[model samples]
Target chain A: MQLHYGFDELKDIDFMAFIPIILPFFAVGILLVLIALIDLYRHRKTRKSLLMWTFIILFVNTLGPILYFVIGRKDSERL
Target chain B: MNKFIVLIKKEFVQMVRDFKVIWLPIVFIFLGITQPIVTHYLPSILGALGGGQGITIDPSMTAQKGGEVLASTLGSQFDQLGLMILAISMMGIIQTDKANGMLAFILTRPVTVISYIAGKIVSNYLIAAFSVAIGYFASYLYVNYLFTDVPFSHMITALVFYLVWVLFIVSFTTMISTIFNSQGIIALISIVFLIGCRIIVGLSTVIDFVNSASMSKHAMEVLITGSVNSKAIDNALVTLVWIVLILFVTNYWIANKKFNHE
Candidate 1:
């Protein structure tokens, strides 16, 4: 009942093994950018702020896209 | 009752007008369809890139076998679904209201605090439930079409258990949203809580009885194996308690405090 991808197996990986691991992260990053762009177009006044968030999302990696979607986007909305 | 209905209608109207309803279902459906496909295809997709390194890619090994695919798919979806649906939905609702100074106006209406809170919670729950249901159905259809020899009964049971789990998560997110006025803080707290719960439950294996009470632990177990035991019941009860506690606190906040737009 070893229910996880063994850490031992993952640790013994090479460059080839890294691609799949990074794909989801990259996809998520792309998704964040799309969302930011869409929101920017909708709210023209906040285009600069939205672009700033898009950069943050691209640079932040693992949790960055999620943070952008949840918190960062909310920051640009007119309150 | 009329006021409550009116409040619910108001919430639904705002949700539709803002297009929050559309994005939620789209996200859930995307996660549902892609998680399994991505997980199933990742290794083979990587191998096809023709790296110079001698990486022997066995297609048989790459595709999940022996029923593990379902488990991994369900488990990953459960973990991700909370952040995607629950936290994101809460942030959309609460932050939009706070940002537009709509909270003050809504509060000034004839609607009672309880009614307003109830409307918010009920509508959010419905949206979450609908999204999860669509995702579950999509996953089921995809799996049935792509593979055979799946234990259909077990999959059905797992789907039912997962729906219950989603309810618990939605309720928990609603409570967290009520406690925090800022969307950033709410999202931060929700992510922290999810990670913390997983770690604590993972630690329970060495600690014996301690893991038995963890909600995420029970949820993962039920979701993967399609089995429900007393511990899962206990976890459900704990989640219910949290929902009630949060509602009480939210009602108190609304009654005693006035919101000022910053």
Candidate 2:
């Protein structure tokens, strides 16, 4: 049984076809980045190395926001 | 019981405030989809990049069972990166409260130590389980779409076995967080130990019988072969025992006020 068609079919796959499939992936990523940015903006005064975190959150894709949340958010706010 | 509910409520509120409610499942969903998508595309990706010069890629080799792909989603993606993310996100579960004197403050409110520990474990376990389940389901959908369809019974059985391991992870991380002070150390220990258990799963039968990571293996086996290992229940019971021991240590640590190191 041909479990999958060969590379010829794969090569013929439309780039436009992938847009819908991959859109959710991008949406989740962008949502994470946006939430991290908004949180960072709100807590800008409490966090140290504000410029660095802002750069990380904007540039590092998905991991950057998670890093911000896990490490950066706990700077000096706990009282 | 009342205090336990209040504490669980407090934990969820804190999760919402921290954006954990938003990000954790999203991260899991991302990780879940990545395995099947990447596997499905890798041959074409290699063919496109390799210039058709030397090695021709075989499509038959790339053809994989849906169960095998789903199993890899747990073994490859969830075990390594997912474990690390869970550990990091939970590293401060108890450590933060201890550091900020919140543990002590909460204790002073006539709350027994058991309820406090129970609250932490129950709330965090629910979140962890929820995140993992969402991710696993995401992987299941993509696996069925891209590969052969796995049987529904096998999927649920594998998930149940895998969740036993996840329960151990939650309780173990909670214990480490309670006993340790630094988030870095807690994260490091939990990640190393959990990943180590996963790495050593098939080393020996004796070890497999006692290892919680074997539950992951059992899950993968169920997915791939559609047969549950007879020892799966035994391994699960052992894992539950480990969780109970971990929680006992956590309770003992807090009850003894051992966290008041100055």
Candidate 3:
């Protein structure tokens, strides 16, 4: 099996070459954060801990949004 | 059949309204790409983070097979964080319906108990399977670009096997949701048991035959070695049987109204 190594020397590696590879990862994360922030903003009246959720979603990265969606969003006043 | 279709449509509508359709796959996609990128860049990341200190990383030491990288995507990323996400997302599959009296209300309709149970499993399973597939495919792309090329046959076959294990996860969580009233308990039990099964996969052969998690190991083996295990077929069958058993328990619990914990 032929293995393609990214670089022979660490210093020789160009960070720009990696931008394409890493871009999707950041894009997905930012999209999630954006969606979460939007949802949290729209439901601010019903959602608990409004300020805290905004901070969590903005700063906590990927997991922050997920946590807010799963636990923070109450969905209904009756429940 | 029409009723089942309606139930499925209703589930899809609910998913869309709840934004589950949007986020679940994205989460899996994030997880899928994370493994390959992290593995490829760990050396540089560590080197840059540390003060050029004690442990220097060798690029040659980081050399890995595309198949190995893909397998770890399933073994490490998908199995741990992926599993938790799935369990958490699905923890309320039936519990929410039960909580809102929707299950009982729906049963009063012309729907059979079988159709009701089937609808829940089918819809949720599709989402779970789709998320995992997208994630696995993302990992495959990165693996091919970053490492050696895994054979087309190996990649496809490994995914088929891995998805069977995912089926078990969905059904098992559904069963727990059906029997338990609290989301926390359901999530806790599903995560613990599923992760436990994954953790004990290679301890013994006797356990391997009945353990649904063996399918995951079989998948990883196919990826790394480019050959299916002799026992993979039998293990898959056992896992299917386990899924059926879980579905049966879920159906039984719902039909008998055993979920009324209040």
Say which candidate scores most in TM-score.
2
lDDT tens digits, residues A1-79, model 3? 2222233445667768888999999999999998888888777777767899899998997999888767767455236
Q: Report RMSD for candidate 2.
A: 2.3
Give chain A TM for each model in order. Answer: 0.43, 0.79, 0.77
Instruction: For candidate 3, give the docking quality class from DockQ.
Output: acceptable
Q: Which portions of model 2 miss their true places by more than 4 Å?
A: A1-11, B58-61
C-alpha RMSD for every candidate: 7.1, 2.3, 2.9
Which segments of candidate 3 are over 4 A away from where they belong?
Answer: A1-12, A74-79, B53-61
Candidate 1 structure quality by residue, lDDT tens digits, A1-79: 2223333444455657556545543464466456644654576565446666656756765345445544554545664
Ranking by DockQ: 2, 3, 1
Q: Rank the candidates by TM-score, best first.
A: 2, 3, 1
Query: What proportion of the real contacts between chains A and B does each prediction keep?
Result: 0.07, 0.24, 0.28
How do the residues B141-244 of candidate 3 rate in per-residue lDDT, one tens digit apiece?
A: 98888888889899999999999999999999999988888889999999999999999999999999999999999999999899899999999999999988
Q: State iRMS for model 1.
A: 9.3
Docking outcome class, model 2: acceptable
lDDT of 1 at B93: 58
lDDT of 2 at B25: 89
